[model samples]
Target: MSPERYARINQMLDNRQTDLTLCLDTVHKTQNIAAVIRTADAVGIHQIHAVWPDAEMRVSGNTASGSQQWVKTLQYSSMSEAAKQFNLQGMQVLATNFSDKAVDFRDIDYTKPTVVIMGNERDGVSDEGLAIADQHIIIPMLGMVQSLNVSVASALIMYEAQRQREQAGMYGTRQLDEAYCQKMLFEQGHPIYAKACRRKNIPYPSIDAQGQIEANATWWQRMREPDPNADEA
Candidate 1:
């Protein structure tokens, strides 16, 4: 990677919000998914959760814009599984649903570890999703339309999170792990070689401070050889 590219990627790693994330409750619209990911990257969200029960949707959803490459998507078979994960992480799950008891999205404190569950375009949040969420939140709409689009809603919620976190100085220091930062520095900074490592099933090389690969001659030689496990695949 060039010096400028290394600096830029390193800065992004420094600003990543490891604790804030979103959960797509079987959101099937590819465009909405892509747009949400773009917004997530803009707000320094490193990853998001998704529930994809349909086999076909899972394949097609991966084709979202380049932003998808930056924001990792953790997929689950069901909303219950996603809920369990949030609980384990100590994340306060907020489901976007309009109910008598639902609170305005802005009222919730976003500085805490959070995962807002955005519902599907048509069906909205599943019954189980609503039941599992610690809080139900909704964006206040003035006009006849009851709600915004799925991706739009997610952006608003995430930005509120970003706003609160910024005020709280969450982004003042680097929160991501050192090893994880090095891994991303290599994988994203050196695309072609990273691809080679994946194709050949070779271990990822350590990345220096300047973002250069620190592998020795033996590792370099292995990169040039065909993968021994290729035939088995």
Candidate 2:
């Protein structure tokens, strides 16, 4: 894809909103993580932050299914680090909990940069995670069910955020920073080429993935100046 193509796709993405984020707090289930990631991408969230002890972070190719490549996933050793980073970037952290003071998830503003923090399936968000949260949100349920699965709950909240953002016209304009979009699109469209450029410490060209020059015989000849003896013709 060329920059123009990327810009066009990004424009389409912009129409669906993009700033909402998902933060997983020590979630251990691979399937839940995978499902959450898939939902995050579908909802047009630009990033997902996974906060777990360094030793606990793990995602296989089968579990992640190239989704991690398409969406930026940040793994942090501590919730404070993740919270600080998002706060510095102007994101409001909404921790999900069942406390008396928790607000309904639908009542919060989703148009701004927001991070929805989901806790482990067994214990829910850690105390430290809750401590850093700007606000607590709860999903209201009345049908003999106390709570939904973490993945299902995440999807519900993400869709709600998407709905609010769409109505507020936050999705109607380009929300992604231009430089960041360019960098991500380049990496997505040309993984090998991008890796090569990084490994070789070469400056990447402004051209898009499809415009990458292949290193064929003609290219080698052009680079080295072909000798007459090397020509079969």
Candidate 3:
């Protein structure tokens, strides 16, 4: 990796919002998915969970414009599975939907660990998704339109979350742990060599200040040895 490239990656990782995440349920449109991904990246969200059980979430190159590469999208086979994992992590699940019990989006305490869920564009949040949600939030409608598009709704809620977090001084310093920061930097900046280290069952070779690996070192030579676990072809 070049010095500039490494610096840029490090900067992003430093500011990443580890407590915030987004979830989508059965949103199959590629353009819509891409738009959400783009907005999530803009708000410093590092991870997005998407549930599209029948098919992989697809995004067009034009729509993504490389935003998908910066954000990690995790696919779940069901909404329950995703909800369970987020619940285990102590994240509050807020679903976007129209309901008698729903509250205004801005009224919630977004500074807490939260996962905002968006459902299908036409049907709104599914019964299953809503059941697992800690709360139902609605973007108030002023015009003739009853609700905003999924991507637009996502952006609004995300920025609100960012605003609350910023007020609480969440963005003033690094939130990610040191070990995670190092792991993401290597996996994203030096993918090929990181994979090699994983395959060889060795620790990742450390990079110099300039982001270049020491290619001819004694430790590296030892790290290149093949494992002898008897899984021969």
Please, what are the lDDT tens digits per residue for candidate 1 over residues 114-233? 999999999899998899988999999999998899999999999999999999988857888988888888888988999889988888999987879999999999998877667665
Name the 10 consecutive residues with the lowest summed lDDT in model 1.
55-64
Angstrom error of the Cα, residue 197, model 3: value is 7.2
Give me candidate 2's TM-score against the actual structure: 0.78
lDDT of 2 by residue, 51-136 (tens): 88856666666786766655678899999889888878788889999998899999998877888899999999999889888899
Q: Each model's TM-score, in the order given?
A: 0.92, 0.78, 0.83
State the number of backbone clashes in model 2. Answer: 0
Model 3 worst lDDT run, 10 consecutive residues: 221-230
Descending-TM-score candidate ranking: 1, 3, 2
Clashes of each: 0, 0, 0
Mark the regions of model 3 whose C-alpha exceeds 4 Å error after superposition.
Answer: 177-180, 187-204, 214-233
The lDDT values for all models are 0.88, 0.77, 0.84
Q: Give the residue spans of candidate 1 off by over 4 A.
A: 56-63, 226-233
Q: How far is candidate 3 from the true structure (C-alpha RMSD, Å)?
A: 4.1
* Winner on lDDT (1 vs 2): 1
Compared to the true structure, candidate 3 yields what TM-score? 0.83
